[model samples]
Target: MKPAPFLLTALFSAAVSAAPATHMDTKAATEAVSVYYRNPNPDRALKIMQTIIADPLWKKDSARHNLSVWAAQILRQHPQATDKWCRAMKQYPAVTQDETAYFFFLANTSESRKCLRNLNISNHSKTYIAQNTPPDISSLSNISPADLDALWTTFYATGNPKAVEKVLDRVLDYAKAQKAQEKSNHKNIDMTGVAAAWSARSNIMQNQDIRKIFDTYLNRLNATDKALLQKILVQE
Candidate 1:
């Protein structure tokens, strides 16, 4: 078909624009990754980091803070992405140290702590690590469902549904055990927390075997609660 000159120019311009972006090479990718890293979307951050990290010829140290943060986010909804995130971190020295304390506490594995040991840590960060312990999750009170999403972020990073379910069991068991306490802290049962927590994992769980585990939690609610939760899950 005969094409308009503008259309041909547009396509050529598109190719040129893409050339710098794709055939663009490592130097440019590294710069782009560093600048917009502060942008909020972790998934995009991870992809950009991958682009920069993919270039073995590139030299400067990649920023640890953004890599850790975005890696954690990508692993949340996309549980299978653990290897990509983990491998990316492994390439950058002490980027592991850049991971937030919340993730350290959330996963609290020997491996997570091992990252701190290799790093030249500050006295303050050292003290924080030495004193670190699993959060007193059972005692959480006046905690809204939205707040619970923070906890979910930690578990999601693990990319293990069993881990998520275990946390649920602990919280539910404690809630069931402390009938008096539950009543006293009505705010603690904030259904919104469950919704928020689900929101993090919702995308990954959809149409997967692991999704059933998430659904099990949802099933605990009444029809109205379930409907409300579904809406929240699908919302932008």
Candidate 2:
């Protein structure tokens, strides 16, 4: 009753793959931050950021922008450590222009503002920050398209049920807005909400919690959108 050779090989492979890496890559960091949003491991999360921020890939706007959001989200959980967060970011002087702009926009606290002031952020980014109002993640009523995009990205990054619920709330909000526009006799109603929900089909199909959300909200959608979603759910 010994294990077969192929089974032994598979077990060995699994054990090797399960071993933790010395440093977190971009995808791994993204996942770590996503989980940190819920679990709030300030020390390990900050260490992960310290590791990945040194990589040149993080200088790219896409990664930096997500980092800004993720960092801000993590900070929200640690209200008392705003100064600590600022100190950590100060170590990275090579932060890109896009990172400067996004981080500046989310830096509502005085300590955060001072941290950015001391950093090597470009004058143009400073001007942009000064001229425009910083986005308030706390206020969903005034959430811009960009912020909504970030929310959906967070849901995809973590697959957390809470993240799923946040996206569902936005989807329902968009549906409501679409209906409001239609009532005003607008010829071209924007179905951004429906489109957002449709875009989440693959993610929803893959997760049980997300699938339950899809089911709960299915009947809430208008006939056309609901039918379209039902068709895809069955076919896919």
> Which model scores highest in lDDT?
2
- Across 1-236, the per-residue lDDT of candidate 1 in tens digits comes to 00111111122233335444445754454344323323435455556656644543222222332233324444444444444444545565543334333233333445544544554445666666567554433355544442244334333333445445544543444334344454575545545444434443443353253466658876887775555544544443
Clashes of 2: 0
Alpha-carbon shift of residue 113 in model 2 (angstroms): 2.6
Rate residue 22 of model 1 by lDDT.
Answer: 45
Task: Encode model 2's per-residue lDDT on 1-236: one tens digit a residue.
Answer: 00111111122223235435643364465455534534556566667666556655455445556556656555555546666656666655544433543553564666566666666666667777778765554455543445555565455334445555555666656555655576576555444454455545645654555677677777677887675555544444
Q: Model 1 clash tally? A: 2
Checking candidate 1 for backbone clashes, the offending pairs are 145-192, 145-193
Residue 31 displacement in candidate 2 (angstroms)? 3.1
TM-score of 1: 0.36
lDDT of each: 0.42, 0.53
Query: Which parts of model 2 are misplaced by more than 4 Å?
Result: 1-24, 94-101, 141-145, 153-166, 169-195, 206-209, 212-236
